[model samples]
Target: MNEQHTVPQAGRRLIGLYPARYRELYGEDIAATFAEATEGLTGRALLRERLDLASHALRLRLRIASTDPAGRILAGAAPIALALGVGESLYDQAWYVEDVIRAVSRVATRPALAAGTLGAYAALVVPWIVALLCAAAGRWKPARRAAVLGLLAETAFWELILGHTWQMYGEFARIALLAALVLLAPADLVDTGRRGRWEVTGLAIGAGLPLAALAASDATVLGVFWQSVPALLPIWAFAVAAALLLAHLSARRPDLFRAAGIALGTVPWLLEQLPRRVPTVWAATAFVVLIGGAVALGGIIRLLRRAIDTEPAEPA
Candidate 1:
């Protein structure tokens, strides 16, 4: 047993350079891994490989703490890559399991999806990590009109051309929407644009176009691309926009519910006419709509409660 794990002190020291929290759990195991790496090593290349592992760990985890430079870059670049990958995957429909495995590497987070979303999350996150690196260097720059147009084209085209099956295409649409969110970044940060996106996403999800989607169906409309980029972006953007716009509107006209107003304004007219046209599966789509409406109304009430909690209460 001793000879099998005969890890040298310098190699162990290198691995042990990891954080204490991580080291306590993995230090011994890593020492064993290095012992294997150094099996024939007495050269500069060997030393370099050992240092590279430590360098990779440092670059990935130990940078700036504020605004999560890594997260930002991931958010910036990942969405487009996801759209491209899924588009490619669709292009290459014939799946070898090895290829399929590589394609959906981020599907569950872990190397394998047998565990759960946490693992899936890890898988989905690699590209976003790259995006975060890009964002760390500079701001995202894209034209708004062009972005909106690209989104419309992409979503509409996919909606039309995708195979007729509901399950596969539904996931496709949701993933496409996520791609749109990642792609549709604001023209500029108006101020300290740290937060305000949920309201925007809520607006998108709850406003006019929702009628089109009100009719429930089996398909998810969300294919798992390298999904993190497209998935969290709009919500993140929404948080930023909502915080800035609402803060300004509140200071200028507190009674107007500017957040809601902006949200309503952002809706497209086609969505407004969605309710009448939505196809019913159960003949009780109307009931589903009603239940959904009630849930939406309940959400507003909860938001009010949160708002009131933060406000100065009057003397009883």
Candidate 2:
């Protein structure tokens, strides 16, 4: 009875990290969930649970804040102070997509637009194809599906980012994003347990190398594909790699990982755009990536809170 009445201190600390509006609304429930997830805790154990939760929240917040576009859209004297600084960051990033696209279009060379569009279309197809191929392996699962959603979100953001550049052998942000999504979502096929067992390995190999190649591409190599089929190679590779990473993370916590990965990816793109050598198109791309990431986080937090809130409360 004493234990039942006693609340976990560390767990409360973890809950404190949430947006106050969130804490005010659902703080007790989250605290309870933390306790449940970290059952059988003592002093150090409680501290670890609290630390993890706080760290996760802090990391995500900083990542979103660093985004240039997100920061701009979120910019204001009042918004930051309100909702403990999470709401402004949570605004729908898609709202700004049109603006970003238009800004990017101004600097796009005909060749760059053509290459990017081709890349975008190709990125669109890769995930569905991968999902179809994995159908036989039975990769379908709820966690995986969630992972895929995260991936698609990531891909769309990257496609927007890379689409702005005219480089030949550029990274397949879309493809990687697609593959990542596929891994997170229902597999194209599900072949019983064997499907996940063997096919998972194949999927990993299929996705990883290509994305690495595309991401690592530089001036000379990318220029070779400036007007040709080789440009498609990076696209294909990225789709596969995204699939692999998403699959792995889905089994873990795809939501948090996606937030981290997408936010971090935007930093580099933005930095590349800050200098003249980087190009104006890329700067526009960075703007969208950062803003988009913040929006994504907001959506996820809302969805999570809703889901958690739906459950009935337990007796104290």
Candidate 3:
């Protein structure tokens, strides 16, 4: 095997890591480039090149590379969604803490139960809070790692403490979605423009409105707010959606990418909420309808924009 033939063969194998469409379009060019680049490379140099190629290919496959619009949108939305999730989870945790405190009141009678409740609360809440703080501060790598830890803690909490149940499935789905977004969305691609402002405003309104409502209520403790915690998911979703819609409508031109990002960000909440709020028989139907409606709305906006663009000029 001469160096010439070996180089192309190795290049071709590396190119195979990309998606089918990518491979079809750029495989030859990439292979040629790879061969030329690695002509005399060996040892650590060759290993580094291979690692770089593999990582780039994986990023493209995940659609989370810096150049991918999906990546930017997801990355921009991930932090916003993480913030909302953290707020909701914190509220939920307050309920858990209240329960723990009450359990502690009876610690003398049931010491093991009280200790277990406190430990469970800590395990479930700490990592998520850490992730949220890290995301808010723009330290996304740590945020992602913390989110993964939170997901693992959540899973253990569900399986060992809560026991496997329908509610557990819903909770797991929400946590898994959050973790996926955190892991998959490249932080460097987060939009720091108008979309960023919209995300910030959405996070504020989504998380704030609920707290305001809670504060307005005469209840002094979270126990009174427990029944409403499930409802908080949809409420936050609605607030964020409304903010994003307002941003889209206010823009000089519609941004389908922004709309798509909004939809993607909403999925976790939608999936988690519908199951909890809607009847079992109607949950799937509602999910489909809501998603279809969003797509249809985007299409309608596009059509309207096209019609305006194609309108004939009027004479004075």
Candidate 4:
């Protein structure tokens, strides 16, 4: 005698949570399993069978529909990109804060200017600091999303509320470049597993960036170091060659592309520091925009190429 099969209403409802592709493929099999397992069951046994069916069906759905490893890696990178962009802004604001404090300490300053500076720092810097804290706690994805939100908030504040200029575009481009770097860095280099070390390292760098800027700006410090250090052109060339060679061997092109972009971006700053060169503002801005665009574009191209490689081959 054949047994009549009937699916519990609860079981059917739970299975519907799965994707349409999953349902189409495995829905009948799951329902049958649930019916057989729950047969001759009363209160507790029937409840347990239903729960098991729900979990097993969900697991199967996930296993079948999961994204490829490359896609997963790229998705995991969202936080880092968000954090880097936010951190770059914070890095700039740290210096701005110090400058404002120094101004307050040194000479009588306009109250409105000081207030505005402090407000800008608060609006822009605090959220990035929070993002760093979140990352330190091993919350990568959420932290980055929050940081992006904060960035958008600040950008809106400057653009609509306070207003911005073309000169500000250079600063915006620098932050964009930082985001591009995080997005474009080789997946292996990200090290998302080590929360303690990564967090500490990131925080230390964030704290030190402003100090490094101050040191670079000081005439005495520059004079002392400028004479001792060789020009960057040779070092830059060697670094690029090394990056290219490593990328060729490892098939890891992201870092190589990023390094090239950074090298391009550094030209204007390097020229500004050179004693002989008086870099024009418009020229420097143009160079920065181009470098930022190049870096961002390179990242997009790499991502697209990876996507193409990962796509399933068509049947002959």
User: Whose TM-score is greatest here?
Assistant: 3
Model 4 misplaced regions, further than 4 Å: 1-66, 102-113, 161-192, 195-200, 203-216, 219-316
Residue 230, model 4, lDDT: 32
Clashes of 3: 0
Candidate 4 lDDT over residue span 1-316, tens digit each: 2122367677678777667887787778777776777768989998767765564455445442123333234333333344434435544664566866865664455776766666666677777777677666666544555565566656676577657776456445544543443333333334456743363345335434543464446433335653233332222222332333233223445445334433432332233223323333333444445444455555666777789889999999
lDDT of 1 by residue, 179-294 (tens): 54344322232111333232222223332122223222212335533222222222322233343334434342342332333332211211212233332222134323433343
lDDT (Cα, tens digit) per residue for candidate 3, span 121-227: 88777877787666556566676677688778878877887798777666678778877776677667655455454464457446645654564453434465534
lDDT of 2 at 195: 32
Residue 302, candidate 3: Cα error in Å is 10
Residue 237, model 2: lDDT of: 28
What TM-score would each prediction reach against the true structure? 0.24, 0.26, 0.64, 0.42
Q: Candidate 2 residues 54-93, lDDT tens each?
A: 7555533443332333322222111111111111112222
Greater lDDT among 2 and 3 belongs to 3
RMSD value for candidate 1: 18.6
Cα deviation in Å at residue 151, candidate 1? 1.5
**Span of 10 residues, lowest total lDDT, candidate 3:** 279-288
Candidate 4, poorest ten consecutive residues by summed lDDT? 232-241
Q: Which candidate, 1 or 4, has the higher TM-score?
A: 4
